[model samples]
Target: MQKKREPVADSLAPQYPIESVDNALKLLLLLGEQPQIRLSEATRYLGVASSTAHRLLAMLAYRGFVRQDPVSKAYLPGPSLTGVAFAIFGRIDIARSAAPVMRSLSEQLRETVHVGMLDGASVRFVAAVEGPAAVRVASRLGRAMPAHCTSTGKVMLAQLPQPELRALLPREQLKRITSHSIGSRTELETELAGIRERGYATNREESEEGVASVAVPIPTRAPGLRLALNAAAPQNRLAASRYPAVAAALVAAAKEIGDQLG
Candidate 1:
């Protein structure tokens, strides 16, 4: 039998350590490293008896921290854990951190600029700055839009692995925000493939009539979430001919925002 390895206590460790809490925390950390864990693997990892590992996993499941797949029977991060991660990102003050970069990009491009975070199948505009031009697109702050229908959302979605992306958008047909929105999962995947190759994404009046946008992903250290920076303008002002330049600007601004976020 393999011997159980104990965690080394440090200066901050409690005077009297609680093994169960320590083991549970270890499991959470393990989840961060892999996509899923089986009961047997957890038992082996915890160096505990099968029943002890089962009980720990059960308590974690009860608290909404982990869930077992009905088919695979492997434990995965649950909704509550995802919620906690978002809460931690919220405390990171992403909006405030991106504000200056958004304002600068808006001014430079003379178009509305936004910082958006991926939320499942949608993208939430966390911060926005409107352009000086009277005809520019309006701010999208605090609004959530279908991920496949907006450049901001698509850019962030492009960062996800294929399995995770498919998990998020399983149906063949997709909801459209406008006539221009991509209509099928296959079509969206095709475009996402191009987005991955080019390192950005675009929308031509997909989310709203007469509006166009280009977006680039904002690199983040966080494991579970992704973000993007976008520039939106009147379609006439942001034609396909301008996509390269607009995407380049968004990329630079995104890097700056990512630095601030860190």
Candidate 2:
């Protein structure tokens, strides 16, 4: 007989000082929901005194569960949360959800397909499927490419608010990954504006020589789920004449993945 699954205990379970632990978890959840939250707001939300909230925040920060911005006095989630997130993601296997879509797109478009997510100032490829064509573009899993020079990165950037986007990449010392890479902030801003308008982005030999790609953002029901789906190929095969059709297919695949996620 098959075994039944057991209910998992909540992290805020009353093993420790229940009030303190609950307050800390509430603070973490609030910070996770917003891009940045002020200390006063946190204290108000927790129904705690300013000093008490500060002490709790200080303890959390000391343990690396959260971080405070000195200038804005705003709190944000720290490395510990990212560590937990990565651990959970490692087990969940987004590749399993994305693989068939990637394979189907690759087969239809005769180009490589990649599923990636924003990581700091870069896009990290989590999954890739190579086309059967002789002149295909191949990307390694876990490869990190600059956000300003890749289709997947631009799609993610387009979704960010101006302040968060500026905070993430203030200066544009964009690397020349290829001759076509955006070399300055102004150029990248232009490209990002276009991406926002079109709901998609493209890279014509911007991340690597002889490679071109188009991407669409994969929307999730909850916040902080950063992901995009892209189709890439050799520049010669993905010329302007062929870009529209490839882009349409990529958009369709992204929509399918988004629907599944929802």
Candidate 3:
């Protein structure tokens, strides 16, 4: 018989699966894959007693791999955990993970689709798929756009704590990418409020002269990172009256991407 190699500390040797570590790793995967998870469900998923699950979660939380919601008692993926995930799963992997789903959504909606990640006060489009149409929103891959004017930027900004938002955006005269762009922090704060309630964000020719778009967040393995996928078209095609339906489509695509990641 061939000799088995000794597993190193950073090894992924499956032959030496340690029970406790395996269970905890599985739990971490679930946390990374979903937006929120409850203790009861976690226990059921792992076929463990509440005490056992609690111990695992408590250890993870202490390590900053998990965060428990104060009001709902649900668990959210923590910043430290996200850092680990991002380190292990590089940026290209994230774009690769969402590619097929982005294509599907673009075809379904007949509009240009983009996957972007927040970079300070801007959004960097990592991947894009164009739609089948004579006139459409142009591909924005490899581009960084102002955060306050794009749908992707708004959705990500809406989730930031007030202090963080202020730190990133500031209270000074905001850049005027277009006449329709949010002109001040006061207006942006009000707009972000509505975006939080609606679970999606929209841009009415805010970033460009005549582009309209809707976007939804795509929760990733990164804890502190914010990513969004958006569908965009000309203002006339993606009219104000069509925002509701467009938002729905974006949300649905985001959900599918989440499920795919899981």
Winning candidate number (lDDT): 1
- List the RMSD of every prediction in angstroms: 4.8, 6.5, 8.3
Per-residue alpha-carbon lDDT of candidate 3 for residues 1-262, written as tens digits (9 for 90 to 100): 1122233689676776787887787787665445566789778877899999999998889999887766567787676876776565453465677888888888888999998888779999987998889898999999998999899999998987665677677666788798999989899999999999989899988999888899988865555667888999988888778888888888888877766665
Cα-based lDDT at residue 188, candidate 3:
92
Model 1: runs farther than 4 Å from truth?
A: 1-77
lDDT by residue (tens digit), candidate 1, 110-225: 98888888899999998888999977788888999899999999988787656667778989899998999999999999999999999999999899999989999887655465
In each prediction, how many residue pairs overlap at the backbone (N, C-alpha, C within less than 3 A)?
0, 0, 1
TM-scores for all predictions: 0.75, 0.72, 0.68
lDDT of 2: 0.77
Ranking by TM-score: 1, 2, 3
What C-alpha lDDT does candidate 1 achieve relative to the native structure? Answer: 0.85
CA lDDT scores, all candidates in order: 0.85, 0.77, 0.81
**lDDT value for model 3:** 0.81
Candidate 2 residues lying further than 4 Å off, grouped into runs, are: 1-17, 47-53, 132-134, 158-172, 219-225, 236-252, 255-262
lDDT of 2 by residue, 1-262 (tens): 1122222565443455678877777766665555656778777787789999999999988988777666566766667776676665667667888788888988998778998888888999988998898877866578998988899999998886555666778886667787888898778888899888877888887888888888888765343557898888887777777767777888888888767654
